[model samples]
Target: MNKKGISMILGIIFTISLAGGVKGIKVKAETNNFTVDLSNQYRNVTHVASGSLYGLSDENKPSDDLLMPTKPNVFTQMAPNGGQLPNGEASPTGDALKVAEKAERSGAKINIRFPDMYKDFPYKWISLDDWNSKIDSIVDSTLASKAANIYAYELWNEPNWTWNAKTSGISFNEVWKKTYDRVKAKDSKTKILGPSISLYDEPWLKNFLTYCKENNCLPDIMCWHELGDAKGVIDVQYIEEHVKDYRNLEKSLGINNRQICIDEYGVTTEEAVPGSMIRYFSEFERAGVESACSAFWFRPGRLSNIITEDGNPNGGWWLYKWYGDMSGKMAMTTPVSQTSLNLDGMASVDSSKKTASVLFGGADGDNNILVKGFNSNKFFNNKVHVKVEEAPWYGVDTKLSQAKEVFEGNFNVVDGKINVPVTGMNKSFGYRMTITNKEGYINRYEAEEAVVNHANKFSNEGASNGQYIGQIDYKDSYVEFNVTAKDAGPYNMKIGYANGNSQVSSQKLYVNGDMQADVNYDSTAGWMSSGKSGTKDVQIKLKKGDNKIRFSNSQNGYAELDYIQLSKVAKTFKVRQEAENALINNATVNLSSYGSNDAFVGMINFGDSYVQYNMNVPEGGKYKLEVGYANGESSASTQNLSINGGENKVITFEKTGGWMASVPNMGYRKILNLSVDLKKGDNTIKFSKGNTGYVEQDYIEVTK
Candidate 1:
């Protein structure tokens, strides 16, 4: 765990027959290095139960209620021919592994989970014995194939239902532990991922996770389900769980490189909302969620997301392909999974000593594990695409030979963190980690070298934003610019602060060492009357790396960084998008921070007036727009939008009606545009507002 944060990266590869070691290839050009090692893949969808794919025959039916196929309580189903779900034949497995081998050849890892549907049966009530028996059956059936892809096992289907509820009297905790322990004993190499909390913010999820930890059931990866991740009727309390937050949570738990995956996740695919799935999937990938499964492959005829149907353009299957089919890279596992090794040898460890047998990449339990780039190379530049063969479990799609590439993205620098993808590639596969550029410009700054700032200075990241660098201290005349521009240098500059009513001082700027030139601090006109009429200017030159400018408040009193301008600056376009309700972080947005009365808050880039948010205007003008519920007065007592600096302008809201929009300007984009009066210099806008109830900000749109 050095400053780089990359430690303990291992590979999971099966030791096949004779030729089993590693195979490798190189691109020859890149410097960062491209390495691909083997890690567990097909760990999710490999469980194959016999005879279900071809359909059961007449003699296999179990005498029961065949009439209720979809009911949650009815487990026994009499087949059309009196057959049980898997009544007919018993076989080891198929050539799917060969396809996996081919996929590996083309730059991807592959595997399949057989006996697709595990918890399709119904059970309203049952004892712990029954649950154990059912789990035993699943494990036995899955192992029957002797296939490595069927290595790890998921707990019974959605437990909230009748069958799972009745079958497992205890919570998923008790059930998963038993299953995990059994699996680990059976195969030490095969890691287990679990307790898939149905959603990120489930009310009862904390208990399940605690159970796992308390019982030493920490999973190799975490799994869970989330339905209609977008449309909010699902009752998820904290809906804005971003990938970074989730990954950070894992890190906080002290699991160095362990992954967090969404075992089951579905985005509303109804064209009703374009990019719904795209945006949803991106959040996890961009945020570094290890893996995500679309809500389900539920009988195509029964639901909207189906991989097989005809005619639809962006159907569920297409999404799978879109998410899966990244050229030679539809498998975004750990970099270990990508390190190609070129070796032609044989090595095997017999399990006769009651040892564990682990399997990874290879064609027919015979190919060697391939690893590439042993040097200090990480081809982190290459985008990752993951493709998981679906299974019969809850409508998961399983096609290894023709696996579709999903999520062809990679990790980029974001706020200085090289955030990478963790999962949610093709649904229902092993966890994946493809570096992405989306995490743009990582920030690993120490406290001394870092200071996070909203445009308006000294204000919380809320609606009540204050003035741009309003010099807090007036007596000490040393000004410090907001660290917006990169690589600001060293120079003598004047800063303003206050000791009683009037005081300020300046200091020579030094980045790493050399002091900057021309230190100037005047007390006569510019120093005494700061922010009154206008402010004075301070200049400095910064080197490439980190530059520090110090301002000393001799008395340690309240000092305001009233105004600061970079002597040498670049052109970075500023565009802010806000919500009518409380939409904080764009990717990790949440709507539960408001009280009953405070349901809305918003932000805007006066410059980009064309792009509206929260309240819209009939005709765009410079009129201020606010978001919040108000009865029939000019201004309701509970104002959704609050301004600092003593209300820069009076925004008379249309007290009544359903949520009205206010247009201060006479016309649309003309004067109403937030950028109506852009002063030549720096502009900082802050936001602050809240109430009793939480806010729900969908978005606010603006146009010319």
Candidate 2:
């Protein structure tokens, strides 16, 4: 075949395969330095629930998956007179307790902050004596509620700046001491956290801690914040370094034992992308910080919310799901460099299940992930399976239609290190890699390798991941698949295609050189949303060994091809019968065998000669019948074929030279396939001579 023909033939050849119905197959290998130790675990992730609870009073918000003991952004601070106290309606502290109760019901830890007795209400300052009265009222009310879920009581918010240092006419130390003494007197059992500073100010924290130590009122949990600037851009490295400095400061002050909580931290202003958030999560885990919220200033439908206004999981929602679903212990995941975003990932392993789940980001090409301490002993020869379901990175619109991309292949593991090769990755897509003890099968072939002649107009993405065939137009333009069937009879052809244009389209199918049928492709959600487009399957018959299948859209139909699959279907067969035994008229029984043990009918030199058969089918159902024949003449011949005396179908017979002739090793007799709906008893089928010319007939085989 010439280049044009070869290209056309190649396009058609790649349209065949075994894809659906196979399970437990691992994907191809990738290279990266993401490794996990199944034996040595650092932190127990199940006990590591953390997140902030901001404006989550209603049930419509997503709060169940985050760590409990969440710090509610609003407690009693928003209510007047601190709203209702346990002492009748005279005081206003019961409103705060009620808010705490709601937080507990929402499966989060109860957290509350005290209001400024003066500024919160009539917008005026109050005397130290008046503050004492309010503090006493709050303590009485809190003691009465007996709400055990209350995790912490923040002394004040942003004491470093939000509270005027020299003015307010009162000192922070004086305010802290009076409230501390009053609350302790009422309920010393409650955990008291202090000086909720807005930023990492060592001088302010040290002064506050030193005074609290002297007065014997040090906070149980030290708290601070890590906020982004006006631009909303947050650097993960900057956050990591600040946290390390905080730890060192704690040790130097002889307060190293105090539990730390950078409760409020965020990388972006209004939008929180999962890739950057996961990096923050890793930093927190490494720094031994307690709980941290995404620092959301607005509610759902806002830029920071994981759930969108339509209630579908937006890009950042899956990250929370993956984090919430993980158990066991945290394994060490070291990237190529601490500053490089290429290998950002967090990994964990469950020894009992022998499964490792790694949530990864920053992948653009082939990378190797080295995993150690897997449960397997000898090499199982199983492939590394990576299932990547990504939502766009918050702002990318195309990623909104993300469908799950799968990559599978075998990998080599020496010693305890299992090196998995992962390829065809787009930057910023969330990847989940799992190493299992169960055996897996490697994918057969890639779609690009089988593509013959795809038009260059359509753009290709995820091509390395076997998802790059597209821009199908016209009937003659197509893709081909050279597929090999281990044992073939009847198979289902599954085609993965996209028609996001919202218009109906179809492609013509050709099996082994004969035009077969047309496969229809309905419009999908979008080109990227393959999950919505789905797979189209059609039943086709294949002979044992290699076969060529082609898909072409000659009618100017519009559709995008992803890949094609062929899965075997169950079939039943009956014995073949000699053609000479059938009823015939102008045809003679040629005893000279044509590769078969039985004799074939020949010498039907005239157009009027016909052969008939009365077949006794054991069951009443649809069955495929194969008639073997040969045409040795220089020119080809056509025969009139009928089933149950139905309308005749003009079947063409290609030239074979002679009944006994074999051009090299190719057989003279070819099988003519046809479908018959037979009754349980007898059915009459016949083959008559046609204007094309004469040919010899061999035995017939029936299968259902």
Candidate 3:
């Protein structure tokens, strides 16, 4: 749990991205008389759309609940993009990404909500198996897409709700450890903050990190969401007092050194619900509060989007090209002014008073953010030397840039500001701020792009796992691989996709087989250029051979392949099943009767894929089970599924193809088995998708 334990990659470089930051010069407030222009804090929008509302997908279609892996405890409503209709649910599409783009453009930082998927996404944790693969895929997609200004990845939303209250608290330790491992495996930069919880509830923070450290998952920053008192009035708003307590919670949890970011902190009028939540946020911020937006439409879905006006935000504030601003607390003109401040790098200034505010926006944790803009305002040439006498298992790198050129080994500052301002840059895409501090560490933005952008999928023309031998048409979208002799000799590997201009002067290839060519977003390259779906082709070279060949990230879409041949993979099959020791203890006033549907039923959660065990049923009735996937077979037609039953009232599930597909519209089905009246015994069920049915069975319950 030591935040400083990991090292950073030194002298790294990143292209400008994310576009603009903070907007609308809200007045600064000196909290507790702490005089610092933290205007950026209030520079946030309110009411981020839930996972159900984000507007993306082919059309504005809300997710399909009937296909839910399991019946949701609460009936979900189709959240709207203001007045806009629904979007897809589950993942982010270009449209959803656009929503985030639009929000950030209008000046909002959106939140990605957990929708009610009938399939029960997180229910996998209850299962005996691990959900590392699914978690990795989600994190991978988030990293690859650069979809939102991801501050914290909150655990399943409102997990403390009524339906989940009785359930044992999620083993946050396990979640953190696994999430850490997954992010580290691919990225070793940025900050992986999280476990965004419902409250600091007593020892919640302490318990969280204790579990994390004990289990090898320490968060860089602890995040929290406080659903403040619903009926509180504006001026008498005690939410501010409550928020301050969050900092106290951090200290109590021994996480004093770790920074705390409010993932969701706002006011509420009527019982603190979602809709009222938005109005609450607006009033609260206007009351001079520092907060971040929960965000709207940061994923691909048709339902939630903050901006109702064709994706443009409508409320408190909206994001525009990543560079959006929120109104700060300072009473306007009380000292509101912007001027060309000097030397100190002041962001804004009051020329009459000659006082300015400076903004030091760096990812580095040195906390060197100076309060006031240099005298009036300006960027000071600074030098930072990070000494790593002792190091961690992996190395960390840092990239420093200021417009004109990427600074590697030396500081590239001439005058105060960036050599070149990013004016006229594509506003749709945040070209990023004029300056940057790329701290290369375990948690990073999109480190994969740092390594060459690869295909989102691995396309092999061979039957085995490590087979790669190809000579086919290569579009900028596919990859090919082959096993060659280790014999020392030059091997010519012509790429299938060509720009055709043959501007072949300074082409370079590193020892790693990563071909270096001028990247063309318009031409065939990787995602930066070619827009392919999942399953495309890419080429890899081998010196002499015996090694497995496959592609990396498939988020850029598909990849095609000519062929692959290194070796054959051994295939093995394991029969999966879901079982129980007793039946749902009947409502016949017999509390002593212990059966599958009793204590054993709701306790079992299935994740990834599973097989079954002992089934002993007494009386069988109608049983309904649901399952879902993390990511795969996103289409209805390819939703391959299976269900097996055992004991008393055995009923086989009728496969309907798309029953176990992706989010919102998840794969679902109902089973009719009158025999399972376990007034005494047990029963079992098993399922899967992909080559395996990616089904998520929340919990098997029985009624009177």
Candidate 4:
């Protein structure tokens, strides 16, 4: 609320238990097993849902989606007049009591700021006696009200800024120690968080930590600001790196691991965009941050306001809603590779609900959601059900009456593999995928079996999920699957392969004695690291009878064929950016962003050179080619983009700035939309400079 544009709120809620009260709550047993095991050594203490509120009015009718336990007041106008209140209400803590009361009713955690009503920052600098009196009075008032949600008291915010500390010529370190001592001497139970530096400045943080250690008055939770996207896009990677630096500094300072609260994380881009906040949520969950709040300067119509003036919901509001509704312990999931290009997402599994919920988006096309990590030992009773609902920001002003389900179906998970196709995915909209259990879903093959060349043996040692064919290095080596389909329709086929080699390996897929598709196996971590291959999806039509599918490398043996998985799901011919025959000229590649192990072409600074991908088109028609990229400069860049060597179209690259200057401003916008016509088989698409700026290229997906 103050000039720092940050606040904390904590109060008794009628429904949800406050943070301090929830330590006694027991969690329900889970039915679905997760990939990220959280059994031992991991604690779900970081309340990623925690946020700051604007005022008591905002608290009167809190959104079920917003999960803020502890909130602080933003404005100093709420301070008491004359170091005292109007009778029986206690002294020097004016409307904060009222604000705290409303906050408690709404079930929030409160972090009350010591009142600062001076003309300027910190408001005023008074004598030691005056400061002590004010602190004692406010503490007494909150204690009288029995506000258990008042977990911590924050000292002056953004003290590192010169204006906030321009009082009585006293150093910020001295003021913090003096105030901390006063609060502790009165009520040692109330924790203190202070010198709330505005930014993650190394020199300032180090100095503050040193001062706290020397004074023997360290905060229970360390707090700082993450409003770094001043000139460019908010770089999620840069923020994560900065957090790690803080932890390292703490360890070097001989301080135990203290909780961190990013009290002021300002949203620079469109709050409604899926790429806007999902990446931050992922980083916070991974690092186990205690709390965070988006900085809101004005009350009613700020771009970052989750709730608008008329009490309607914004697109960003629904993201928090999905997050708030999610239950159970945070489950482990395989890192989504597309997130590197701004396809952002966070997944949680509630075994009790029989739901594996994922909040995903930031692409301009239909994205693929792959499920893995299930084993034979872990079993589910029924069919796997998946539903995707879109959360568009344009006119979604009111609370969601009911989420409009765009796609819903029941599918079988055989051999612990399944693909949940996400349609209507875009950067401007968000989608919540709920995968649960249903009764009638049936699988023809619980465990698929494949026949390999007698020369190559089936080895369990190098398999990722189950037994895979290995030791095949000669030409004409092949593996075949004898699969049966109950119905004549298109099915999604996933091939599990492992190529630990540094070079690209090729295989021709033959169905019923006819050439079907060319499978490319890229380098993985190792032979045993089956996850490195990822899941390659191909569309294959099967007759309502027995069929034979064979994968062979006629030229040279490539990778270890792991398994063949088939499901009665929709089909699409998808090609990744890292697919084979890529001609790189001026661009370089690396694993730069979130969940990306394969390299993406980056730093396209020159104009003459280009990188081209030889695409293997399944069926050529008018198809949408979605390009994934990020460019965070203030102005948009342009590229000479073409498909199948068609007429060159000017591709406008939008600015996707980042937090760090050294890092490229490649903000994640999962997909860039383009339309092109192609012939049935091989076609080449190239990216070259177009008399303008540079852009980072992730990959392109072509679909009808």
Candidate 5:
């Protein structure tokens, strides 16, 4: 059978199995065992690094807020004036630089593909002079712009299929040498990466490297594409072998091992499938590949199928977000089966945070996660807190909420090992297992039962409490809850909400008739869609008796409220003070479309203009002082912060694009966290202009 036929058959089989169909087929359901050694640390977590080819159509197509959560490491885009789409239309690379700037702002790198500038898929060969001129423009523009995160310039893209030696009047090897020399001559610091073949071909790579080595034009980074097959079936089962083979080839050629970057990877079918994508992530991290970008198969600006066309996160995005959330050293993980796309996982241990996380999927059924080598005194005592959550695949178009926690409990750590049994695993979903030493008491309150004023209560199958409070668009609309507390202290209040608005929605959270903070909610798949509820946590202070807590739209907010959870936390101190409520000097309190109480302290450009707040703490030594401010200026703004009238410390607030608006069409606010020392009892915190720049202060959160 042809490759297409085989791929089709494989797709059918995968579809059947993914849908949990087993009629007439005897499938053995057995536990897949995996081991995670906390002591055997290999590398630091790369923040779940991954990206896409031509995934960014423009600067704000998907918005930086949407892309920031995934923590993309590198994105491959067409060079200037390139990027011709499959449809005859062109997405021209003119905006590529702007996109790069935005990506860098979001802490992601960029790779520019020179061949994509041709305006054709196979790339109609323009003359050598034309190519050189384009290369010079790219190098010169890049150098002039000073984009530090522009990782590497891909000399060409998929040369095996796009290049024609006979028509170009020169071998592709010579083309590489010419382009490589041109890039270096213009700006020596910029790195050139190439030989981005369509797929892994040993002979092709070996010959290319040999020619480059002899010609003294070797690429700074080796590059290739791993887009399984034409029918979009993922064939990444042997990616480890491919990496090993490339290393051997590099050794035989007497060349030092260079960093490998799979510039483009994944197929259409596997792009949005979290379970299938795990296979790619496992192999890439296992082989120690520097970076990789998900192939843009269907469309641009959707983050390689992690996002939908409607600008909502699919299930796959959540999986990647979980990966990005990983911090500290990556622990060694071994699966029972690794030769094929069976069950596999990656583990990480953040010793400083006293937490360990494992992300596993690919195959379904029951699985056992055996975590070992934990020092009892280091991470846990005899008992450890465990939470297992799943990021379910609800089709590519369906929006998804954050990963749902399926199980939570305290497990005994016997002999530095905890065997976690995950039962009835679904192949389409990716699961996250978090082990932490901290524990807290949680109290849940249904929003529908709260005293609703001008807001309507409605039934939602997806809501945690089966009912929710909605129509909170009016200024007077609110849902209030009167709950009693055992003690007077700070508690973490988690608000479960659903906001289908295009941008982020906010609600003024009130504690006893005073606005405490602004609760921001990102856009979900849809209003009350199953498993699409979003959550935000804010610390609230309550008295020993009854306390009135309310979510009000008095500040131009709109979001469907599902439920509220109050958890008693230990050793954590967080107090939020709104800027509008602060003692202002020469600053004006203006009504804002965003932020707490729909108001902010603006016009703080003068040296004398300041905002001060009096905070009272039970026992304060050192605390994280977070200033929620917005700077719409061209550059970052600075403010002088002082605790208890101490020495003034200059704090820089990065440009937030706009002061009162979320990122263009998305809803995301920025805040700067700084460490400050405070004494017990009453303390005065102040913010004044230490430097010359416009800054709008929203609120300040002091957390210890």
Candidate 6:
């Protein structure tokens, strides 16, 4: 048979498997193709503008760095001195303003929901005079603050269910007009956003807009909510249709067009999943909506759901960060299915930066991204550097290190296009494809090519080389790869492996006969599953010329190895300081049977207790400070970190789910990474008990 015939048969088989809902079936069909037209730039990169309703519960809950990376365009919060949700805590307008300076510093805005000032979830309305007074007070305070980013005053939130016109002795339209007039009377310049309904109801919106237009109280920005029903199922594909309907409504009424903002969107189930959230982003961007906010379903202060409870970036956060990183102008992208929850993507071309980025994912199968009109731009020659990465969804609580680079190399532009194939996609994972004009290096060594000792080579449909080394269950079983480096001081070693065990597995790593860190592999669904392969990265020192890298079972490790990749580390200066070496106050350094150096600092529950480390760095500007700590509490813990005697920065440490006494053997030890700015020379970094819980310190690693 011809190659094309064989391919067609395989494609048919894969399609049948998909129809049967078979798990772990790898598909190679190129039917899910998305085209990116680089020459057609639509709008600036504002798709990341989506924020959350009541996303910020406190002023300092989610640190500034965590919130800044998402580039929130607008956040909806409750009225001042009002947080009476029956279930979870919600950010009030008063405390929300405290973060407005930093949250809105980068052209982001905050929308205030006034009805929440009544201190009831359903909102118990008082007399009309009392409501007017409350509105006046909030308006006066907002005007007095001089906060430029207080974008709009939302008259009410979700009035479809929360408001009662008959009981209040006034119609909702009358109430809206009265509130709108009162707010504009106090602050004429501040924009007013209105009729913030629960969902996109055509009748409700038409009536509200008609009344507002007739009363000469038309909102400066049109606002509504797009949330799932009681079942927590939301179809984001309808966002474009709803926006178009609103535009047509404006034209039919002969009213001036208004900026649209879905102040509250998404549901609990879709908040943290990258694949689900990317569709919302794509739809919102394609519809040219001015701004939007994710609906806060679970915990507040989590930036909708991008952040975990312990203040770590979840898989969804990285996807939004990638969207935030995009600059210049967004290019036109045509997905395979625009109206279905299938393969879709958003692309952007930054000519000034000489880069193009595409973020895509929505289905679990093979896909292709066709980049066209690359030759139309003068920034590209015949060849361009491309790097493809996957941000895997590792549950909400599991702290992920970073996005793994699945493919990286230089690709020649054929004619005026480049077809980038992506395979074995997990529906919950989001993929990022970057094209740059600069050349880079990424060396991948397949495990099957390595010298295997007591290990068997097996085939995997999803593996890069179509084969992997497995059965490394004995202590002596190992795989060693001989690699060459150009000039390496330190390089990032990414181990591609599959561990289907119930718990995390580990493999001892060796570089040139010297033992390195124990690489941890999180559990997957099953062995050789198409979308279940995972990667773990560790920093290792390599010689300039040749190096022998080995991975062996520490003590019956049960992870199958796929491949290992070596890339030049962006941060050169990495320093590890043991907690035992720090100047401990009110804390005891106990000898531990686990972790590095076998000693840790404990008894950090006192208010004045601290462990200070004085160290010098080689020309430091910005560095990542990784705190190794263990908190076995049922809930998350917190600690205060002060650098160079500066104001303390609160660090939330997630519950390790176990302790040294409970699990032992490095199972409870976890690293919390924080970005800090340091001087070129000496600095004193201290961890103290300021609004903190009991935590044991292992060691701190600083890298830049």
Per-residue C-alpha lDDT of model 1 across residues 379-421, encoded as one tens digit per residue: 3223222112211111111112332222221222222222211
TM-scores for all predictions: 0.32, 0.52, 0.31, 0.54, 0.59, 0.63
- TM-score winner among the candidates? 6
**Models ranked on TM-score:** 6, 5, 4, 2, 1, 3
lDDT against true structure, model 1? 0.29
Candidate 4 Cα outliers beyond 4 Å, as residue runs: 1-42, 45-47, 55-96, 115-134, 162-168, 229-233, 268-274, 300-304, 333-341, 376-382, 395-400, 439-704
Once superposed on the true structure, which residue ranges of model 6 sit more than 4 Å away at CA? 1-30, 85-94, 229-232, 443-704
Evaluation by TM-score, superior candidate among 5 and 6: 6
Residue pairs in clash, model 6: 51-294, 571-704
- Tens-digit per-residue lDDT, 267-331, candidate 3: 22111111223332333343333333332212333222222223322211111111122111221
Q: Worst lDDT window (10 residues) for model 6?
A: 1-10
**Candidate number with greatest lDDT:** 6
Better of 4 and 6 by lDDT: 6
**Lowest-sum lDDT 10-residue window in model 4:** 22-31
lDDT of 2 by residue, 1-704 (tens): 00011111111111222232111111222234555555556777742324453434333343443322222222212222353122112333323465555556644454455653343421343566776777677667767788766667666666766665455687888788878877888888877776777667777777887788788888887777766533434455455666677677777777747776665666322234555566666666656666665553333212134554444454555665676656677876766557655566677766656566777665554454556654442323233343334534422111233435354433334455554434444444456666665534433333444656744323223222324466666445777877777676777665655555544456777888778756665444355223222345566777888888877875734666655556566555474565766888888875331223224678777766877877766589998888778888789887787878899888788877556323121235666777778787567777888777777876677776
Distance from true position, residue 419, model 5, in Å? 0.9
lDDT of 4 at 8: 19
Could you tally the backbone clashes for each prediction?
165, 45, 140, 28, 1, 2
Q: What 10-residue stretch in candidate 2 is worst by lDDT?
A: 1-10
Worst 10 residues of 5 by lDDT: 1-10
How do all the candidates rank in terms of lDDT, highest first?
A: 6, 5, 2, 4, 1, 3
Each prediction's whole-model lDDT (CA): 0.29, 0.56, 0.28, 0.55, 0.73, 0.74
- lDDT (0-100) at residue 19 of candidate 1? 16
